[model samples]
Target: MNLSFSKLFFVLAFVFGLFAVMVIAKSVLIPLSMALLVSFILFPVVQKLEAWGVNRLLAAFLSLLMMFLILTGFLTLFSTQIMNFSDQIAGFTGKIMDTLSEVIVYINGNINFIEDLNREELIEEGISWLQASSGTLLQSTFSTTATLFTGIFTTIIFTFLILIYRDGLTKAFVSFGEVENQDRIFRMLQKIQRVGKQYLSGMFILILILGFANSIGLLLIGIDNPFLFGFLAALLSIVPFVGTTIGAVIPVLYAFMSSDSLWVPVAVVIWFWAIQVIESNFLNPKIVGSSLNVNALVAILSLLVGAAVWGVAGMILFLPFASILKVICEEFDQLKPIAMLISNDISGDEKKAAKNSMWIEKVKGWFK
Candidate 1:
């Protein structure tokens, strides 16, 4: 009893300590964690380049350059579109106001009490609140942007160094374990690296597929800036369930504002719905394959926990983190039970088979 109590206490304390560190050290941890995953993903490119007689440092640099160029191109495209749209901000504002008025009228019609609500007074209160919060919001926005850039820069540098010295890092890690355990550690690391590479690549491919599908659907439905809305939604879809809904709102809002026909927004909903179905049923399972192996419930919980700890970064990082943790748990004999508990691979079929086998053995014993 005492031993079990002690173990429970220790485990709870350890979990709390880990969460505290994650919350407190997010600035450093976030960049470092990103760098680790990025390095893992890029390692194969570096390896291939090195096999072609390129110097390790040069290969790593080339890999980084390729990534930077692709990123720059995407950012340039998004920014240019945003700047062009900004030129018509006044028009958009008017449309927004009109939409809000329509919504207010619709609601007031449905509710007698709401008919007494003064729209002008509500608008005035909202404007006053915005004015009060504007300075703080602006400051926060600036700080967040600066931190984001800093984190990206730091991640790039760390990823480069990691790629260059990956062999040394592996050797150093292996040296910490006993000689017999060193091989197991190396195997564990390899599994982790494979999972990281496959997972990241799959995510990238999934995003592109979603973006293409969404853009095509929107274009067919006559939504303007289809690519912009589609790609933005694809990016948000990285956050799991809430992200797709959030992304869908942009095109839906545009449809509501720009179209005289009521069917436009309804079409927008159908388009997103179809894409979501395809993505959930087909693209994810086929492209991502068995790399993540995190079930939906656990994945959602991890996203929630990660968001609570590190906001958006947590949501992005936690899935891969869970994968690595599962690998570690499986590698250690004492932790096998934990691995089973967390693994999505322990599916219904496997459990059913195990139960059937147990029943067969019990029947056989009775016959004997």
Candidate 2:
């Protein structure tokens, strides 16, 4: 019993130490994590280019350029929508404030929460605060934007370096294992790369499908700028359980503030509720979840742990890391149970179908 307790304490200490290192090195790791995923997505292209006798450096550079152009195009579309949103933001804010005043009045009448409430004074004070903080707000925005670009730049460089030195890295990893296990280690590395590639490709398809589905539903409901809201919501849905709620809430809030009929927001809620059902039951399990093969329990645990450790970036990186972890655990007899626990409990035909994914392969075909 004492031996068991000692072993448990050691395991706990090891886990905590691992997490501490991750938190401390996040600035470097986040970019590297992003690059590792990106490299997997780009690796096939690199291989094809090499097959065509293209120089390795040139191939890596070209792949980065292609990635940059794709990102820039999406950014251009999003920026145009941002401009449109900015134009109407003042009216939207006013409507939201008006709705808040009505709610306050209702609560004051029913609950007698406060003796007197002056919303106008509150608004005036809020505006005064904003006016005073405008310079600080502007500086913060500029800094955030700069950091975003810098992070992107760093990710690109790391990706290029990873691609360039992939051979060396593979050997380094394989060398860590015994001679009898080196071949298995090499294959494990390949599986890790495939997991990253497949997860990302599944995500791209999932987002596109969700964006169009959301936009169509909103258009049917006669919501303004349905595409913008739909796509923005779809983008947020990348974060998992919490993301779905946030994505839906944004549009629901807009409907509440802007539409005259209370029924409009109700209908918006109904649509998103239906979307949540379909996505959780059908789309996600078949698409993204299949790629990760992570059970909901493990996925949620990782999401919470990642959020606690590395914020938004952790949330994004850790799911794939979990998948990679499963791959690693499967190699050890004692650890295979950990892999089993992390994995979805599908078997036979279901497991085979998950392994035989067409999603990422279909996405990859577009590059050719």
- Candidate 1 per-residue lDDT over residues 1-368, each given as its tens digit: 12356666787999999999999999899999999999988998999999999999999999999999998898887787677556755477556655676677668778865646776676666567767998999999999999899999999998999999899999998898999899999999999999999989988988998898898989999987778888989989888777889999988988887788999999999989988888888887777747887777778888999899999999888988887888888887556555555677644697766855664554344323
The TM-scores, one per candidate, come to 0.88, 0.89
Give the candidate number with the greatest lDDT: 2
* C-alpha lDDT values of all predictions: 0.84, 0.86
Q: Which runs of model 1 end up more than 4 angstroms from their true locations?
A: 1-3, 105-134, 347-368
> Candidate 1's error at 70, in angstroms?
0.7
Question: For residues 54-172, could you state the per-residue lDDT of candidate 2 as single tens digits?
Answer: 99999999999998898788778778777876787777866665666777767877888877767786566656776899899999999989988888889999999999999999999
Candidate 1 to truth, TM: 0.88
